[model samples]
Target: MVFSLFSFEKIQKQNTTNIPVSVIICAKNEAENIKENLPLVLEQNYPQFEVVLINDASSDDTLEVFESFSEKNKTIKIVDVKNNEAFWGNKKYALTLGIKAASHEHLLFTDADCKPKSSLWIQKMSQHFSSQKSLILGYGAYKKKKNSFLNLLIRFETFLTALQYFSYAKAGSPYMGVGRNLAYTKTLFYEANGFIEHMKVRSGDDDLFVNQVGSKKNISASVYPQSFTVSEPETTFKNWINQKRRHISTAKYYKKSHQYALGLFFTVNVLFYILAILLLSILFQWMYVLGIIGIKYVIQTIVYYNAAKKLKEKDTIYALPILEVSLILSQLVIVFSNMISKPTHWK
Candidate 1:
């Protein structure tokens, strides 16, 4: 086993690592957020990086806002589209332009509305980029203290989302990622034809892209706190619902294999619980439902609670129950809306 041991050590040392990264933000009419969060981007403590913002023809002062910062900071470059580039109106089109302008080989993406929660966000993320995988997943959370039950619900949704991808990537089956805090190499983008197939859709530039690059070995995640992308949660339920519905519109295009995996997981678990509850009176069988919920939720939370502590949001656990309940309910609504009409535009 001496030779075998030497080869194993060689393979272990070959794990993914840090490389220069260009964080790309696509903005449209985000003057307020651009001003508030851009400094956070410019102030990252990392040694080597650049910030490229694609001003997707915002009607607001977004271009002027970024112009001031770009003047002082050489790393920040703003690409302005005349609001007439696509004329069809899609965020992915703006993102594609941003990718072309990026100076580095690795692209880290977030929205103008998002701010990195930690200075080490880049370092934590870059550690996961390797030749084995072209993509790395990062977490994005709702901004702090944004609401009551609604805010908690939003955070919980984010938490469980973190759990699903982070855990599943470790276990081998990768699903999707939140665009607000994700990274991939420039080479990977071009190799995948860089979102050309899904360009027409308003959403899924992130999800669809991940679907295309899905692989248990190649896909990876950084669940640590410093790498998390934190942004304002939707202030109103109507607004949040609208944003979610737009996101739901992209689900129709997910790969059939990914769709089957998700459907089986969710349908099987949900159906078992519903059946147990129906037989609760005669069999007390629903007691088993509580056990399954407790175990899965706890194990999931424990993993993420460690992540939250790292990210400095230990208090997020308080929102857990509300988030889970709302997630189950809202998904049904999203599924129904998906059937009616394909949603477009962000309200």
Candidate 2:
């Protein structure tokens, strides 16, 4: 787990060639967000790129916002998606429509609520793409709140997720990528059949698709600080848990190997804490147990410190122990809750 930190290094060779890119955004009832963030996206510092906006059957004024933006910006193209009886509430269907409408082969994806951390977001992400590499994974972070514990939890989870996925991508078996700052090729999407296998499974448009199509040779991990997208974190724990339920529910569908790998890693961490507690209470080799635990924390803290610096979540390193324990307990609740009932809404 610690060795994966090496993968966080910036890409050494950037693709300088002007790659005409298509930025695909699928939004539902995001008029307010669009009004604030779309302008920054349109003003990106790139040679040639078009923003493809998909207003997915929003009841609000999302379509009006897209049209308003299109009128002023010639580079903006809109794809208004009607609700499909068969694929209702499924984001993949809306995203597929947006992908089809994209004018360029190189596709970059972000949510309507997200904005690039830097104008070079597209350049940094797209630079990793080449003839062999079809998929590019970039970090998507949440906005921090000064005194919000929920905000800390959200950002820590996002940081840890990026660390694992980036490491796995660097190792060759890429299991997932976040949608807020992911890129791929149009031909690659078509070749993979464009989410046809999991259209009904609402939340895996980004991670699940990458899990199906990602390979060691065809994928690249982009970690430059400029290659990030930031979005407002869920303000309430209830809303965040609901969102997490939808996201975590998709893991059961990953390939068997990935399922085993992720499951084993999580199991080992949980058992380590459980066994340590039991041993310390019984006074069974307590000294050795403490020594080993101390060593583990030292190493983990060092690695997390470096990773936090690279990922720009440095505040999280201070409360790593508390955050890890809280995250694990909450995830256990979510997993059991999901087993009892699946998340209803995808958005």
Candidate 3:
């Protein structure tokens, strides 16, 4: 089957003199990550852009690291939020401050733990913005470590998430974007009131805000290799599960249409495997059951391989079958966990 829905047109570089970009990053006790990743953002090849780092009450040497960078690089701006009882563990507030501090109209956002895939990251991402488009969604991939089941599963899950969001954006029904490599105009944030409604929630700094303000006509995507950002994956299963739980909590706040769409997708995915297993158990229909399963697998492999290639995740194609099963289990666990408890920390 042809996967035209996930196909993306490459973005050509354009003269960006009139469109200076501001890159915002929110860091909380990310001293080590900042030491390694901040320079990549500061050294971007874009002509006119500033890096705004929000040092959100880092007890570690994160503030010192930001100060060290600011001393040499004039483009580096810092907003240090001191440890306050009122603003403890709130990334949305930090991000809002960073946006307000941004000097340029076009704003790009990424986390302190993420590094751009190329020096031309800003230039590539900014090219998608025009007079009409206000939002730009880019791909954020995790670094591929040693060949292992957990690593492959993580990469596969990331690829599938990108596939759904990117395909939906291409289909003109944009729903969400990852904050690790997402960009939008400062005007869009201000006009949308800047996450005021979901301030109480720990997460939703990225997906929730986009769901509220994004539309088919206003949002564009940048899937070019140069525009992507890469970040370190959670090394332990406990950390990864917690991260997924925090992310799942934000789904409840999505628009009704988006909720329905994602819900139907997950439901169909779970049911597909369940029915396949049941049909395989019936000896009389073994041949037909195996054929059906084979056909579905072939289609998935083709679509996923192409999508993975475009996103620079080609190595993950080999693990699609196992990853798909693990994804269903992960989804079920996250759904059940969210029902019992909500994530309290944004970190």
Candidate 4:
């Protein structure tokens, strides 16, 4: 987290740049979201870009919404996908068709339920691409709701996850990137054979693809708020936990080095709290334990404060300690729950 705070840099948007990009959005029953959010995508300030809307066998009016937009906007291209028995509930197959339909080499991806924080999102994300760098990782934030504990918890977890991935990418060990605001070239997607390696796993259309193709030299982290995408947080605890279960189940497919690094960090934090609580209950080495815990909190607060400001989630700073503890406990429950039963399909 500290490393990301100091090392993360924003890419300057170029004037008179002509890199054509295809903004791909795959929706499964996202009619309401597409109606509300797709205009912002269609109205982006980039010079050359097309919007590829993939109606992934949506049962709702999602395809109708796409047609409504495509009728008026010439740049909007719609691909209607049917349910194939071979890849019935697989998001990967839908995304592959969308990628193939994209008219440009550079592609930016976001969820149907997400909207860019700034119109310069395309310019900001695509600016980092060069001869060496193909993957651009942007932070995905959750919308804040007043007087909602779950909303705050969701935002804090998103903030911390960004800190870890951004810090790791900055430290030359790129691990994962969120699809809510991630971008890459069409050439790289095909070169890596896309998501074929993990197509059966419904949840990793974003991170697992990054884990397979991301390298120290080819991936860049974008910390600018102009590049951010915001999505609605799950409204209920049960829904959020199920959503997390699907995501956490993908961790096992990550490279071994990343598994160890991420696992060690999580294990150390979980143990830190466990040991602190045990020692406090027993009143064993009371003063020393309190001092160490105090020091850790102080450092964590400082790091999280700076990171929150950069990511535009500073509202979460006041409840950092509480949110961290709650998130840790929730993640433990999610891991155990996934072990007992596999996570559900992507949708």
Candidate 5:
């Protein structure tokens, strides 16, 4: 709980006059997303940066969209990966190619389905890089829509995930980061062997790599509103559940220390709710159950409210109780699903 009070003060913007950065995007069948979102990244208010767009064997108009953008924008560099039998459906491989093709040492990564919150996104995220720091983790949020409970749940879960990782990072046990908004040096990527350890797994290009190389001193975090990226949420429950399962599959590869810490937290959380229900139903200790749950809720609301304000998440604090319970149940489902299944693709 003390970690919840971790400071989120924004880092002072560096003089990026000559510090060039390569923004990398790995896309497959993201034609509409690229048309809609790539412009926001291309129009960032930064000094010198190039966007390295990787077309990873898309069967759509994705290549045409990239070609159109490349023709008009000199900063856009297109890398086409077509019919590569070895690195067919792996995002890490595409990212490796993009990193190799990048002209700058500093590299920023984001999904094609994401859009920056502001033109200062590049400035805010890149300002954290220094000689000592090699990793910068930024907040990636889901766009809020009207009358959508699934959207709310997705956003709430994302907020809670961010809360845990950011708190852990600030507490000197940095573990994971979302690919939608993350940055690191090319040297750090190669030094850590460029996700070779977890490349066999489908979905670890961002979090697992960070878990391997990130340290308290070497990693920085940016939660400024201007640095945030917004991604579209899964509209259907089945799609969202599949996405959660795919993400959970990567957790087993995290370091043992992180696994233990996260496991303890999950165990306590599930037990807290289970015990509360049991006490109320059998023991008939309604007062005690209510009191305990009330205390926990109050503390969580306080911490989450502050974090949400920093991350610019609005209207979610009111749904904390429902969201927390739903998240616990969803975690149980995801863990169970992962136990009986193996993920084969990186989609």
Candidate 6:
């Protein structure tokens, strides 16, 4: 029997144990975020951890911000890119440097714009390290919001995507991991060649790496609330769409099997919706339209509710279908635009 992309097996929950972790952050012009968010990294409750802040030639006040943080927090080391390198490009280089400077056998990674939801974030991630392992998958969420329809829209989009990936993982179809709060075995990273395959691409270092490794018994997920990191969302739809698009285009480089899995999903949902509308239109009945929307949302509510409950994405998952339909439309637009222009910065 062929391995199913959507399988029933999952990364069984195991007790993670004593192992030191080295946290890495790659930043460029992230001064505002660094000041507001970097302290959380320094103050994490985890005892045996070091943070390496790789300044990738930021032309802004990022250097000054790091210098201030470094003075107060000795655990924070500012590693600057040297002119010695004859060839270097985007963030992958900066991340490689951060990984090199990391001290622990296990590496926990997050962005400067992210903050731990709870103090135990480091403890939760490090536990997956076990006695001797090279990789651990973790989860991250968007910051909470109660005002503005836009904020709700953004949260809904983020929360739902989280459901699709993580819930899919729960069903045994783990594809990629998020960099905002991902951990890996330092040794395994080097052994896998460290982003060599997708180095030139602006994104996918996190997702593609996991795609390469696939699901082994060693891969683990953290369910504790304190372990998750929450990142600031792009305030505007245009900005969020651009950032998401760049990430999506990198999907083209995904492993064949993984690619087929995602394709199956997108194709299924889109085609199903289209077919439902066409078939029901032929009936020309209001009840059919209502039934279609109602049933879809019902299924969505179940999957998303389970996802939200598991991922700590709040109760927003119930609102997924409405958000998901819009998400699918926006995804199409962004993915199409990014085909011509590769977006680099998160506006």
- Considering every candidate listed, which one attains the maximal lDDT? 2
TM-score of each: 0.85, 0.96, 0.95, 0.95, 0.95, 0.88
Higher-scoring candidate on TM-score, 1 or 5: 5
| Candidate 4: residue pairs that collide | none
**What is the lDDT for 110 in model 5?**
98
* Candidate 4: Cα lDDT at 319: 86
In model 3, how large is the Cα lDDT of residue 118? 95
What tens-digit string does per-residue lDDT give for candidate 1 at 1-347?
11111112211222335578899998889999999999998988888899998888788999999999999999987889665555456777778888998999989999988989888888888888876877888888887674477777767667655655665565566768888999998998988888888776767888888877768778877766677888888888878887888776776788786677667766865675566566675675667767876786776566556555544556777656555556777887877876887666742
Candidate 4: RMSD over Cα atoms? 1.8
Report residue 263 deviation for candidate 6 (angstroms). 1.5
Using TM-score as the measure, name the better of candidate 2 and candidate 6.
Answer: 2
Error of 5 at 58 (Å): 1.3
lDDT by residue (1-347, candidate 3, tens digit) is: 11447843444455554379999999998999999998888888878989999999888999999999999999999998865576578898888888999999999999999999999899888988988899999999999899667778888889888998888887888889999999999989999999998887878899998888888889888877999999999888778888888888888889898899999888988899889888788668699888988898887887778788889888888877787888889878888987898765764
User: Please, what are the lDDT tens digits per residue for candidate 5 over residues 214-239?
Assistant: 89899888887898999999999878
Give one digit per residue, the lDDT tens place, for model 2 in 1-347.
Answer: 63444534555767666699999999999999999999999989999999999999999999999999999999999999999899888889999999999999999999998999999998999988899999999899999999989899999988988888887787888999999999999999999999998877878999999999999899997778898999999998888888999888899999999899889978988998999899899986789989989999898888777778888899998898889988899889899889898787755
What are the Cα lDDT values of the candidates? 0.75, 0.89, 0.86, 0.88, 0.87, 0.73
Candidate closer to the true structure by lDDT (higher is better), 1 or 4: 4
Better of 2 and 6 by lDDT: 2
Model 2 misplacement above 4 A: 2-13
Q: Which residue pairs collide, candidate 6?
A: 134-185
The prediction achieving the highest TM-score against the true structure is 2
List all candidate RMSDs to the true structure: 5.6, 1.5, 1.9, 1.8, 1.8, 3.4
Better of 2 and 5 by lDDT: 2
